[model samples]
Target chain A: MLKEILYYTWGAVVSFVLAFSVGITYMGLNRKVTARVQNRIGPPWYQNFLDVIKLGSKKTAIHHGVMHHLGPAFLMVSSVMSLLIIPILNNGRFYPNLNFHGDLIFLLYIMTFGPLGMALGAGQTGNPNSAIGVTRGLAQMAGFEIPWVMALVALMIQYKTTSIVDLMNIQAETGRWLMFSSPFAFIAAIMAMFGMFRYSPFDIVGAPSELASGPMSENGGKYLFTMMSSGSVFAFAKLTLYTDLFLGGADNLLVLVLKTFVLYMIPVLYGVVNPRYRTEQAVRWFWGWPSFFGLLAILQASFF
Target chain B: MINDKESQKIVDIIQNFARKHSLWVLAYGTGCGAIEIPPTMTSRYDAERLGVRGAATPRQADVLLITGYLTTKTLKRVIRVYEQMQDPKYVIGFGSCTINGGMYFDSYNTIKALDRYLPVDVYINGCMPRPEAVLKGFAKLQELIQAGKADGSKKYKENLEWYRANQKEVIPVWRMPEFNW
Candidate 1:
């Protein structure tokens, strides 16, 4: 028992480190790509690393209360937990025993843990802008979750299994990735992923111009650092989950990285040139065609 | 194990390097000099290449860019913002207006010298410094950071009384909270 616990602990640590490094690097690439898109040379790829370190090194920190301090801790925990649950390599070669039998629903709930914790912390700050930002974020979450959950339900029903590992095995055996097999579900999930990525058109929560970063208006120094790091980890977790679900679970680290990076670019590239939507508009857009695609996906799953 | 002091020294060096590379500016454009910021940040000049990006709020910013002549009314808001910012923060007094109030030097409304109110780490000269000059000023600030000479926050803390007095004299009401270090 003790040996198993030690192995699990080691696995968790490795997963955390992997998620952080890969996620931060992806962010740096995103910035570089965005700069190139705008016809300007961007900062070095290590710019994000320097930013996080600089934020961590700030001379002062402010906390409204215990919850404010704990918010980032919760965000970190949720992302870390999600990373651990999502298998990174095929047949779970990387961390074999760590992938539990049934974590699909748990993964969905865990994904929201960061935002919910952040909302509570923002509430305690008593800043109206933070409150506004949190409201928009929660609303957007609700909007996206419908189509997202529908996509997941369609997959679960079609596969007749709750275990992600089982889902991967099914995909490998059938020799048809879910992306090709269930095109409607893929479209719906991809649409929801845009909001999950918090890119342009759907980025009402932390509208920098309108709300001064919204929920994070009061967070600075190490507080901001923690948020940024957790965000990267969460980004990796979400991307990995999508790759496992839609694309066949990657056979190697290189394939996994490429799949995840391509998946990440969908929302990011969309965000680069588009103007942002108001909170209501964002919610409406998610519910409109995306919801329709999700419904069609579910119907197709049930009928065929 | 390394001693605490040794660890702290190593940490300080790392922190300084990171801080120099990622300078998030709260460009609180209080005057016409605000117009120049777009040119500086856009594709033409690309301030972002130097890792100098605009921050939306004082909380997230490392450098406060006071872009031009500050009237008495605006000075109050500026002081409030400066206090809200977390430290080890730097202030850049941009444009000749910020140094000696430019054309507004004799005006009763505008405050002539910004450093009297806020500890400025760098000053860029010109009626309105072009994007090139603005970039040069940022380079100067980066040099100051590397040399360990830009300790404006520390200076502000040490001479809080004098700074506060100057602040209060200009604004008679003195309604702001004392931002204790």
Candidate 2:
């Protein structure tokens, strides 16, 4: 029992580190790519590392209450928990902390756990912008989760499994990636992903121009640092989850990075040229074509 | 073999280096100089390459860039914003107006100088400093940070009463929160 516990703990740590580093690097590359598109030389790839360090070192003054303190903590917990649950590699190769059957449903619920926790914290701050931002964030989550769930449910029905690992295994056995098999589900999920990533046209939650970063308007220094790191970790975990589900799980780290980076670019590049959408517009957008694709996926899964 | 003092110095150096590279500017654009900022941040100049980015709120900001003229009316808000910022913060007085009021020097509403009201670390002199000048100001501020010379926040803390007095003299209705620090 002791050995198993130690091994799990070690694996958890390794996965957390890997997720964090990859997430931060991806964010840096996102900035670089955005800059290149605009015909400008961007900051170094490690600019985020320096920013995080600087934020961590700075001191925070004035807290609204205990919830304000716990807000970032809650976000961190959600990110790390999701990271642990998601299989970093196929068949428990490097670190299989917790990849159990029916984990898909659990993963779905746990993913939004952080934002709800954040809303509570933002409420405690008494900042109107934070409240506005939190509402927008939750509303956007509601908008995206419809198609996201539909896509997942379609997969579950098609493969007759609710386990992400099992689905991945099925894909490997058949030598057919799920994207090609359930193209509509892939389309719906990718559309939901645009909102999930909170890139252009969907970034109203933290509209810095109008909302002062919305939910995080009051957060600074160490609080901001924790949020930033958690965001990076969460981004990596989400990318990895998508990779495992649709892209046939990678055998090694190199393949994993390549696949994840390609998936990440879909949203990052899309965000660069497009302008932002209002909250209602963004929500309506997901409910429109994405939801239609999701329904199609379900129909295809059920019959064919 | 490092003593406590030696180790402390090493930590300070690292902190300063990180802080220097990442300067989140709260551009308190109080004047025409604010126009130059967009160009500086955009494709042509790209201030971000130096790790200088615009921050939305005073809370997340490291440098308070006072772009252009500060009138008696705007000074109160500026002070409030400055106080709201978390420490180890720096202030950049942009344009000649911030330094000595420039064209607004003769105007009764405009404050002749900014340093009397707030600690100015680096002053960029121009009636309306261009994007290039703004980048130069940032580079100067970075250099000051590296040398451990930028201590505007410390100065504000140590001489709070003096700064408050100056602030009160300019504005008649002084109903601002007390600077606890």
TM-scores, each model vs. reference: 0.97, 0.98
Q: Candidate 1 on A150-246: residue-level lDDT in tens?
A: 9998998888877888888888999999999999999999999999989888889999999999999999999999999999999998999999998
Sort candidate 2 into its docking category.
Answer: medium
DockQ of 1: 0.86
Best candidate according to DockQ = 1
- Pairs that collide, model 2: A201-A277
- Worst-scoring 10-residue span by lDDT in model 2 chain A: A56-65
lDDT of 2 by residue, A220-303 (tens): 899999999999999999999999999997999999999999999999999999999999999999999999999999999999
Tens digits of lDDT, candidate 1, B1-181 = 4668989788778888999999999999899989999999999999999999999888899999999999889899999899889988999999999898899989998899999999999999998789999999999999999778999989999999999889888887777777854
For all the candidates, what are their Cα RMSDs to the real structure?
A: 1.3, 1.3
Q: Which portions of model 1 miss their true places by more than 4 Å?
A: B4-7
